[model samples]
Each structure stands twice: as structure tokens, then as C-alpha cells.
Target chain A: MSWMHTIFALILLPAIATGMFRILRGPTAADRMMTAQLFGTCGVAILLLLSTGMGNPVLLDIALVFALLAALATITFVRRTWHGSNKRNHGNPL
Target chain B: MIYSILTLFDIILILTMLWLAWCLLNTEDIFKAVVLFISFGLLMALAWVRMRAPDVALAEAALGAGLTGPLFLSALRRMNRTRKGERRLDSDENREKEHKANQEQG
Candidate 1:
């Protein structure tokens, strides 16, 4: 059963790695941000799998924190960074 | 079987992290670099978990991925605004100098 969890975790790593390419070729800031969102989701999943695989329930708490922080980071980026830029710089397209 | 599988996972995780770090440093766009950095922090936390350091993983995810990313983004925005302001101020100063020279000539 632990092996199963480990295998699944291994499979997800490639998925996140492929998302890195999208970050690299992004034509806009939003695209790169979305890739980061994907990374957050995958990170949570991998953490959960590891918790069960290693028989250490403590990793579960780390996964929960990861999930929360990921959301916070995205909200900060959207509100403080992206939204403010458009409104504050009316004449410029920054 | 378990040993081999774990070894494979470790190898893949290390390679992915290395690639991400390389991209984060070399990317031309600061926004992309910030995003890559957040992702890298997340991966680094996972690496700590693999090393049986769950406490460190928690800290990395919270501080590195969560806090540092927003800080960088805000800093980037502020820097851009200030640079534009400075450029405009420079132009205004040049205009003032030209006006003063014209008055002196008159």
C-alpha cells in the first residue's frame, strides 16, 4: 500500500515538470501565474502521498499548510500586484 | 521493489528541482522568475519531507513559497513604479533647465 502511494507520487513529478515549460514560454504574466497555481496543487498531492507512504502522519500537517499558503500567494499576486498595476498605471500598459 | 521505486522517485525529484532552479535563474522575465521560484520552494519542501524533515518542509512551504513570493511580487511592482517616476522627473528637470536658458537669452 505504501508502495502504491509512492508510485503515484512518482508519476505526478513529471506532470509538474512539464508545467515548468509553460512558465518558461509564457507570453504574459498571467500564464506564468497559472503555472505556479498548478505547481501548488501538485505539491499538495505529492505531500499527501508521502505522508501515507512513509507512515508519518506529521506530513499531513505540512500538506495542509502548503494548500493554505498556495492560495494566499495567488491572492496576493492577483490583488496587490496584477490588479494594482492596471489601475495605478492608467496611461501605461505595465 | 520498494527500495528501487523510492530510489527512482528520489532521482526524478532531484532532477526536476535542478531544472527548475536553472530556469528560475536564467529566465529574462522577472514575473516568470518569481513564479518559478515559488514552485522551486514547493519542491524543496518536498525534498525535505523525503529526507524525513517534516518540520523543515512546513517552514519552507510557508516562508519560502508563501511569504517570499508575495514579497518579491510587491517589490517588483514598487520598483517599476519608482523607475517610471524617476524618468519622468528627469524629463521635467530638463524642461525646466531649457526654459531658464530661454529666459536668460531673452
Candidate 2:
């Protein structure tokens, strides 16, 4: 792995560590959820860095999978948290 | 220098995971716990990558963090709804009891 890639990947660790505080202390579900989203994005970035740093194309594929899954997860969150099964029951959401 | 940096990263990642796990386990709020658990999953995935295991990292991100986090939150919301329903029922029962007591007194 080249120094540049190593540096790039190393930078994300502190960022992730910082995100943990919000997860621990967030006042609302939405705040915590946003930090969770941050994790997905940061994970994607770190994986990309690792793929390029290690010169392994397979890691890129893994990162792509993470990206897709992360989007799906976020969509699931939005659907459940905001648009839950309420619309079907005469607009009364529980 | 890179070796030292990587080792330092390993330490930080592990510590972060431990602290997040503690927070997840100790929080009174279920929603906060779910979020911390998800963050812990992400950190574990990163640790996998550091160990040169992209396959494990991929699985961790998909199943551990991404998929599980929202499911936990939704389940919590459902629990909240049930608790609210129980509270409403309890309040109605109390009202009925009060009515009965007033009728006996009168």
C-alpha cells in the first residue's frame, strides 16, 4: 500500500470515533439515525480507500455492495420512521 | 511510520468499539441503544478491513449495521405504540372505576 492511500484511510478513523459520541448522547431518534447514516458513508469511503490502497479490485466490489445496502437501509429507515403503515389504515399511523 | 500508524489505528478502533458497546448496553433509551449498536457494527466492519478481510467487512456492514439498525428501531417504535395503547386502556379503566365509585357514594 502506498503512503497516500494509507494516509487517506487512516484519516477516517478519528472521524468515526467522533461520530460515536453523537450515537451515545443524541437526544432524538432522528439525531442518532443521522449519525448512523454518517457511519455508512464513512464506511464506504474507508472501504474505497482500502481497495485502492491494497490494489485489490475485489475490495471495490465490496464497497459497491456496501453503498447499495446502505442506501437500502436508509430507505427502510425513512419508510418505517416517517411513512409507516399508517397510510393504509385511514391515515392513522401508530 | 506507517506500521506505527496502523497499530495506532488498531488500538483506537478497538477502543471505540468497546466504548460504543458499553454505551449501547447501558443507555436507558432503546433508540439510543440501537444507534450505538449500529455504530459499533460499522467500527467492527472497519476493523475487519484493517485486518485485510473485505469479505467479512462487507457482511458486517450489510447485515450487522445497515440491515439490523433500522429493524431494531422499527421494533422499538412498535413497542412504544403498544405501551401507549396500554396506557390508554389503563386510563379508561381508571375512569370507569371512578364512575362506579361515585355512583356508590351518591
Candidate of highest lDDT: 1
After superposing candidate 2, which stretches have Cα over 4 Å from the reference?
Answer: A82-94, B86-106
lDDT of 2 by residue, B1-106 (tens): 6677678778888888888888889988876777778778778887888898878877887798767877887787677656754332236776798689889999
Residues B1-106 of candidate 1 have per-residue lDDT tens digits of: 8678888988998999999999889977788888888899988998999888988888998899999999999888777867775333236776798689889999
Instruction: List the per-model TM-score of the A chain.
Output: 0.89, 0.81
After the best TM-score superposition of candidate 2, give how far the Cα of residue B57 lies from its true spot, in angstroms. Answer: 1.9
- Give interface RMSD, every candidate, in order: 0.9, 2.2
Task: Look at candidate 2 and tell me the lDDT of residue A47.
Answer: 76
- Docking model 1 quality class: medium
TM-score of chain A of 1: 0.89
Distance (Å) between predicted and true CA of B17, model 2? Answer: 0.9
The candidate maximizing TM-score is 1
In candidate 1, stretches whose alpha carbon ends up further than 4 angstroms from where it belongs are A90-94, B86-106
